[model samples]
Target: MLSLAAESWMLYGIACVVLICRYVSRWLQLGSVSRYQIEDYIMISVFGFYTTLLVTMNIVVHYPTNLIQPKDVPNLTPELVAARIYGSKIVVIVEQTMIMTIWGCKLSLLYFYHKLTFGLVQEWAVKIVAAYTCITWLLMEVLYFLVWCRPFTEYWAVPTDNIQCTAATHHLLTNFIFNVSSDLFIMCIPLPLLIRSKLPFAKKLMLCLLFSLGIFVILCAVLNKYNSFKHYNNAMWTYWYIRETSTAVYTANVPMCWALVRRIFNLRAFNSPDRNGIAKLPETPNIDDVPATIGGGEFRKQTTTPQHIMSAE
Candidate 1:
């Protein structure tokens, strides 16, 4: 448990730094925080929930909980049972915050995709995926609070006969399915666009790699569910929960930091011809600066600027 706490905090710290950079990149690109896009603000809110999850998970680890086997339940004192019940309640908070943090990242990515695909046929695909993501989140919440555990109090009931209430096997399964599938759907939105763009093969590959970081997030989700199912008695899934949320936060923000990166390094390779046939970077990066080759070549004749070429890379 000590090791898990340490790992969780370490990952959370890294995520914080990445998110700070993401905001700085956006601020620099857009001139001020007032000009920040919707996705940028969404991620900020998600980070708030991420912080809450980390704090709640700490409480869960340190607090007593009735996660013991049936044989051990008889041994618990009234005071100990009460403590366990309180811890069990904290567990629900952890679960809810985790879901919110992960899904919030998903929503941020969908909005970014919506911006990326705007003015192109792919915009419709982004809209459809966004709807699907939102619907899945709603259904998952319903299954969690209303369908899976009846009476709700059973979730923290001490020495309860209903294992499902405590272990939350059904909720974990449904969450895993929803989490992984939504991640896959969001990832699919950018790959084909990057592939079809007339940019250099290396740049395309690099951009695709940036978007593909979602794969790691998916892997973390799988590990989280696997451990929850296979080792529920020991509460081993907590470590992976932290890892999964941290990875999701990272994947969502890293792509947006490219503009800052380019500005810091002064990378000139992104330069392309404008209407006057002169190649240069924009004074402030914006989605409009992206080369027309991205959306099925529809923006080919558009003025070229690398300001926000891969705003959500």
Candidate 2:
């Protein structure tokens, strides 16, 4: 119960910080590009939705209990039946958040790709990748829920029959593999192109750093995989509360951290709260609109600075 409370509060606090940063970024017009703006909203939505659900589930799980069990006839104790029900809900929420966050990360990657690349082929690649990512993760979400819904008691307790439940474990493994692969793919996609851009090593390094937040996401996936493998057949309560919360904390924070980095660097386009020295650039064509000659090739505007990008890395 204490663990649940701590996790809930931490997630709530993170959600609040992200929200404040988002509004500040918007007010300052720090986030000027359309793609960046969309990624910001998506990040906020993912964090907000997950945290809210988790807090609510914790409330339900910890609500005042006063049920009389037949076994304890004289001295009645609070029935934990509701805890099981709510516990299952927590697992579902955790799985949902993780799946959604994976999608959010993929979208963020695609948005950066779109902003950085301009040719027709590059544009098509972005669209195709976005479509595939959304579809795959949506299917994974559906699979998770279907597994969660089988023989309701099986969710809150162990099944009497040795028969397997839905393909939840399989789905999770698939999702984990998919996410890690996607993270590596997204991280590598622009490297060769960046190398060809002929930008200074410093500039190229900065761009790579900005996209490197995906590494944290991959790390989170690894942690989740380890936790799941270590606790494959535990009681539902431990399985749902401990393992699920750990995954939620790591997965949900990825995008929030990413957004916070954008906010700190004043990269996203909203007006800064204290405009002491960082002069606000005009909201035209975005920083990515300028085409500079790199390597032997000319690339469009890549406005990200070294410091701003490296912090995220």
Candidate 3:
């Protein structure tokens, strides 16, 4: 029978593969209105790079040993000590990727705000909030690495009983605090603007529904952080693995899916060009389609494009 941990690990991997295909399909569709933005490209690269490192580390560390080592045999040098060292490095990389992916999602939300919100103040506010979020993430990661880099073995092993090492609690809490803050920031940034937008009732409802999807990601982060703090056993290895992989895979995949689904459903808020400055009114009417007079008075019949018609009161 499969254990819960093993099942979660398997499901996590499958989710990653599913999400990767989803992203690639969007790139290939030629019909998805969603062009991969800079944030999207960064997310894909980070996900791919970190996943490659993780798989490589898994093979290097776990492949050489058989299911059992003979009890009579003495210890021998493992396939490569490099795997442990590199695995440690990859753990750090994966963490960075998670942090980057968070910021990327936040920026994508801000970009959505930029595209959807019309006011200059709202645009500048999103930009400033994005900048602050990015800077703080970078600083925290840099500080984390610096703390981890001292003697390095401090990360995975206890070098000396006498040497006091930085508590993992400190790092974990710092990370958790910032991640939750960033998530709340992403969730809150566009609310006021969205509430005040000129979109019709239906479109406004759709926009809220779409934005709420990010809440799923925030929940993932919270659960993953809780597991990270609580896990301390061999069985919990699976917890760590699932948490890392799921947080990476699901968060990355969901936004791409949202964009595609919105495009397909023809959500007027997402599709209407007038909402994004891709439309304008024409000053001149075609002579072939002239005015219609009513009650002996002359009046020009209103001519509106499909986009304009959709942006109704």
Candidate with top TM-score is 1
- What's the best-to-worst order under lDDT? 1, 2, 3
TM-score winner between candidates 1 and 3: 1
lDDT value, residue 2 of candidate 1:
61
How well does candidate 3 score on lDDT at residue 176?
71
Instruction: Give per-residue CA lDDT, model 2, range 45-130, as digits (tens).
Output: 66655555565556545432222233543442335555544454555555566556456646755764664454423556667667
Candidate 1 minimal-lDDT segment of 10 residues: 288-297
Top candidate, metric lDDT: 1
**Clash totals, every prediction:** 2, 17, 0
Reference-based lDDT, each prediction:
0.78, 0.49, 0.48
Select the stronger candidate by lDDT from 1 and 2: 1
The residue ranges of model 1 lying beyond 4 angstroms of the native Cα positions read: 269-313
lDDT of 3 by residue, 165-274 (tens): 22345566677777677767766655654455444556557655655666666676677667655752223433444455455455445544543444555543232346
Which residue pairs collide in model 3, if any? none
Name the weakest run of 10 consecutive residues (lDDT summed) in model 3.
288-297
Count clashing residue pairs in model 3: 0
Backbone clash pairs in model 1 (N, Cα, C under 3 Å; residues 3+ apart or in different chains), count: 2
